[model samples]
Target: MSSIASFVRGVETLNGWVGKTVAWLALGTVLVCFATVYLRYALNTNFTWLQEAYVWQHATAIVLGGAYTMMTGGFVRVDIFYGKMAPRNRALVDLFGTLLFLFPFMAVVGWAFWRHFWSAAVVGEGSPNPGGLPAWWLLKGTLVIFVALTTLQGLAMIGRSLLVFGGREEFAGTSSH
Candidate 1:
């Protein structure tokens, strides 16, 4: 149990780091957009990296930040069903949800997208609209980034479920939500 607790703590800490990293990345995206706008209008020159940067930078932050949403119980779901359940029952649902639905889906997306991204890299893929952006690396990176963060949060959720059913949760000062 203590080992699980330790693992939960470790996952939680990593999730926090991922969340912060993504937040900063999003902020940078915002700045980049502003720069692009300024460049386009004020300088009379279209920025080359803006389109690719827009897609991947925003996507990267979103991917990296998804785990924080899951771990914090911020994910959109059926509260009508969930809110009525007892703590133990809720834990059960969470455990099942993470294992059966969430993990598999994220895993599959990560797996498939990783390949797509990798292929893009291998082929030196890039936009070809005369002056687009080179961003196969950035786009592909999001596949792992999102999955890794989400997986970490999923592990923490699993740990929380274990705590709940084991009768050790009351002392843990943790809420599955």
Candidate 2:
């Protein structure tokens, strides 16, 4: 049990590190936006790539950081019924939801998305926008990446549910034993 707790702790720590990285990348997007405003309005010449760059970075950061958000309880949830449930009941609800819905969905969608990504990649696809952006497949790949991480997050959630049901503190809340 102690070893398992340590493993979870390591995952949580890795999650924090991943979150910080994405946050930094997102913050960098702010700087990129600033540069775009300068280039477009100030220099009187539009940089189309800048816009594409922002979308790519912004989306990547958010998707990659999703697990970290879940780790920190930063994602929105339908908590109307959740808040009313007792602890054990809540755990039960969470266990079933993760098992029956979340994990399987992530797996299936993640698998399906890779097919889309591969088709795009194999065809060397790009958007129809004239000088708009290059290689649409690159952006589409984020779907697979997001699903992979989000699936791991689902696994973490399941671990948390199990620990909670067994009456041991999980996530970042409990002291190391």
Per-residue alpha-carbon lDDT of candidate 2 for residues 1-177, written as tens digits (9 for 90 to 100): 566556566666777777778788777798888898998889987777777787788987887787788777677889898878766676677678878998888879888889999999999888666666788898889888778766666666666666777787443222122
Best by lDDT: 1
Q: What tens-digit string does per-residue lDDT give for candidate 1 at 1-177?
A: 889888887887778777776778878788888888888899988867685687667887787778877776667778997887777888888889889998999889988888887888888887776677775666777777778778877878888888878986562323343
TM-score of each: 0.86, 0.81
- Candidate 1 whole-model C-alpha lDDT, 0 to 1: 0.77
Clashing residue pairs for model 1: none
Worst 10 residues of 1 by lDDT: 168-177
- For candidate 2, list the clashing residue pairs, or say none: none
- What local distance difference test score does each model get? 0.77, 0.74
lDDT of 2 at 163: 74
Worst 10 residues of 2 by lDDT: 168-177
Residue 165 in model 2: lDDT: 71
Off by over 4 Å in 2: 84-86, 170-177
